[model samples]
Target: MSFTTRPTLQGTFGMVSSTHWLASQSAMGILERGGNAFDAAVTAGFVLHVVEPHLNGPGGEVPAIVATARDPRPTVLCGQGPAPAGATIAHFRSLGLDLVPGAGPLAAAVPGAVDAWLLLLREHGTLSLAEVLEPAIGYAAAGHPLVGAVGATVTAVRSLFEQHWPTSAQLWLRGGRPPVAGERFTNPAYAHTLRRLVEAGQAAGGDREAQIEAARRAWGTGFVAEAIDAFSRRPFRDSSGRAHAGLVTGDDLAAYSATWEEPATLDWRGHTIAKTGFWGQGPVLLQSLAILDALDDGAYDTASAAGIHAQAEALTLAFADREAWYGDSADVPATALLDPAYARERAALIGDRASRELRPGSPGGAQPRLPDHVRSRVTHRVDVPDPTTGEPTVRSDGVTRGDTCHVDVVDRWGNMISATPSGGWLQSSPTIPELGFPLGSRLQMCWLQEGLPASLVPGRRPRTTLSPTLVLRDGEPVLACGTPGGDQQDQWQLPFLLRHLVGGQHLQQAIDAPAWHSLGVPSSFYPRESEPGVLLVEDRLDAAVVTALRSYGHEVRLADAWSLGRLCAVSRDPATGVLAAGANPRGMQGYACGR
Candidate 1:
């Protein structure tokens, strides 16, 4: 792990959670200095670039939702960069390629994280950008220890560093060798960038435009140029001997401008949730919540077997709808999916028995009327039973990737910042040369064929699996939580949320308890048929319960009791006015404090 660990806090109340403790402490310090949640979050976000660069960076996209105690509504900030102006499905087809990773400049979209941070401060923050950035600057300059996780990550992605950008390889690898856990590592270049931003912010009188301009000046060009160089290097091997340096140029970065649009809102179970329509998977989460509510199950508690089963079924259906019709709301109208009446119709069609033979369908709001008794020819494979021992075969692997971090800040003033910054699964975009972050491989997550709502297109945002959530009780936020797992994010979060909210479990108990994920639905990245109705469960599940589920014809895969998609949560008890924060014991860390 090439990251640092330490925790510190300043305000009347504060909590910080990240893979790296030093980065968390950086944010805590901001709060102690009277900076609000937005300030602390911004401080954390910038520091993460230096400590957890692989998971997130200044060059990535961030989709956030913020609600100030003073303001009644949560504001949605769309930080997911859009597709390059020239990108399209036909382009990939023309190149005779099934899929391409790190699409370079051609896949680049205007980055919004930097601008989003500024917007957050302008709206609900009380600290200056310079003040917020101090911790990150200090870390970058002083250096920190490399952890086992960070070391392993660097080794795994060595090809990315060696073959992509020379500068990246030079910065991350010392003497052409990846750092081992516990080794001290420094990022002076990144440190300089942070210092520049701090100095510029101080000069700008703290205006949004001035602050953003300073950040852009520090990050934009050099980052974008390195990306272009990386693309030119052709890091990954393809089927053909010839390496393709996808279209990307320095000019794109020069012209890139982060744009702010009016946010999207949906009423779910009578609570208004904010989403940036097409940008990430924000809209999808809302749609799923709406679908679940329409089911109107009077006994939807996490402890009840029926409740868990029903929620899983509902998630499957909602995901199906997402595959068919969700995309950049800028190009498609997402409001149609929010209609409650339509969701009710969709909920009515779900059957109890497994429908093994089913295929993808067109996007129609919730559920369109299907002809009564109309039989379709598509047949799905039935779940194969393991008869030898009357036990289902279950296997689990530790699959990991970079790109994703979530921060939830609740200030003494009652303001909150629920932001999830991500990117890096794919490298930084080459088209926007020197811009530090990569464009999302989000296109790969969508169906390529025409007629689907998420079909590839230029300048359109892909349907992302990243979702930052906040749970409110009696019109006040009770919990701010989220995780970082490409598509598995929601799959992991929904269950934990139920356990904590409905099952009355404490934050750690809900997060550490056994969890399960269904493979019956389409994956956000891969588009393959014959996805087994396999449910991946943690080892903690009782053997008897596992057998019971298998008897219902569901394949089960056993995962390590401790996995990285550990849930981080901050829970507030309204009655007692007590706040508790917990980090997943499965390798991740978290902290809590109050005045």
Candidate 2:
């Protein structure tokens, strides 16, 4: 009846949504083959690695929130690997560096996405490892159409590939030129690597779990780990314009394993929202929800200027706490930070006008200390803008950047999952010729400061920006959603939740709505810059609303009409056996499929 970019797909069987169409189709195919949501999701995850190589790869990391049909409680699948055993603040400072480089092996964590996916398959999935990996392997070996963004990303970093990372040049450039958009591009090396993993799994015989474990061992302790260790030892150029060897080794790879953990959850307006722990930026969403719930119902009106101001201000407060306290440490005051009293105190700080200061509240009278890089706004220069080098931004400069990828799947049996897989872009680091992928630069999120929550430490997970969300209603899993923006992942989801959960909009209508996010908190990416009072909004929002936002002492910047959010979501109705899905139309890549 009303305008929407596409219909919110409704069916009785299954639903899948992802950043790319090929991945969406592959997942739907798995579901059609009688596989459950976990199997479909694993298929999509691997296919995404092949198709969206500019955004994610086999060497990256992923974190997912999942709920099984049998057990309807949310659980976090932590695929985010930790800093290597040798990665210490002292070691970095001794190398004449104040912060990790944005793009190099020195910024790499142990590869985690592949292991994490395998773990999920081994524990929850119904299909064999080879069965789920088939689509990605086929795409890699037989060639898939290169998207325009991927081509442009390669062109932007062509000089770097040619001069410093020749191995990368060899893989990405054919006949001394970057692949053209829409042309079929093949990566035989990646295909071979995946096929070898399948062989390793098959060699273990017909036990699905054992087969998966064998493949996991092959990745961790066998040839894959050896290749990474040897290649990372070579000096490579990074964001700092210097050549440095990485700290990762075969031991780091062998020691790391994807684990399952309890999620940080908050109940609001009869719906329970779940996210990863303080180690990720996921809890910031929960904190923001707590702050918003403390306000009047009128504040939930996402289409209004006053409501937008309220949401941005609340997120600003939550992200400030993220900077001060959130990390992969036991000392995080998470319980106190999510207390109702703390939310009220934080809510009371929001005013009619935007606040330009970074204010982190004291939870339970504890002192909140922010890192020096955040407090002093220290920044470093990067010569080239790689796809995953920095936070997702709408810059006035001609620099191009890419962030992450997301997939959400829901099956007929009530199995649901939301995963954000990212890092290890083609330009993140030099590609390993044998593996056909580069190590992820996730350590760029850590600071060199000692005694801080996010300080670089051996065997500690870097505080990551990858956050996926799952929601339950009436004791059943109802919604799974996430996006790929660096710091804005949760910021964008806030308004979507408000519109759909409270305002009662259709899934597609909610996703098609104009989006905005605050840049008031320290970024979780390289250089870690923060803009105190800035808010970026899609220009499609009411012109009068933009004027009103500026009147509220907010520095508002207008982006293209559909450029703010790249979110994907899927939902299941327990009462009616109905499934629905939606995908962002911003990039013209994301797709949603269902029966």
Provide the RMSD of all predictions against the true structure, rounded to 1 decimal. Answer: 6.9, 2.4
- Per-residue alpha-carbon lDDT of candidate 1 for residues 109-193, written as tens digits (9 for 90 to 100): 4455665676666556677666777777777778777555556555654665576545456665778887887787776765665
Lowest lDDT 10-residue stretch of candidate 2: 391-400
- lDDT at residue 459 of model 1 (Cα atoms): 59
Prediction-by-prediction clash tally = 33, 1
* Candidate 1 lowest-lDDT run of ten: 389-398
Using all chains and alpha carbons, the TM-scores for the candidates as numbered come to 0.81, 0.97
- lDDT score at residue 553, model 1, on the 0-100 scale: 63
User: Where does model 1 exceed 4 Å of error?
Assistant: 1-12, 102-107, 163-165, 202-209, 216-242, 246-278, 294-299, 329-336, 354-403, 425-443, 446-451, 526-530, 572-577, 590-595
Which parts of model 2 have CA positions greater than 4 angstroms off?
A: 378-402
CA lDDT of each candidate? Answer: 0.56, 0.88
lDDT of 2 by residue, 1-595 (tens): 6799999999989999999999999999999999999999999998998899888888889999999999999999999999999999888999999988878789998899999999999889999988899999999999999887777777777888888888989998879998898999999999999999999989999999999999999999999999999998999888777888998899999999999999999998999999999998999999999998898876788999999999999999999999899887437998999999999999999989999888999999999999887888543332333222222321212122338899999999999999999988887888999998999889988889888878888899999999999999988999999988888899989999988899988889999999888877787777677777878888899999999999999999777788878889999999998999999988889999998
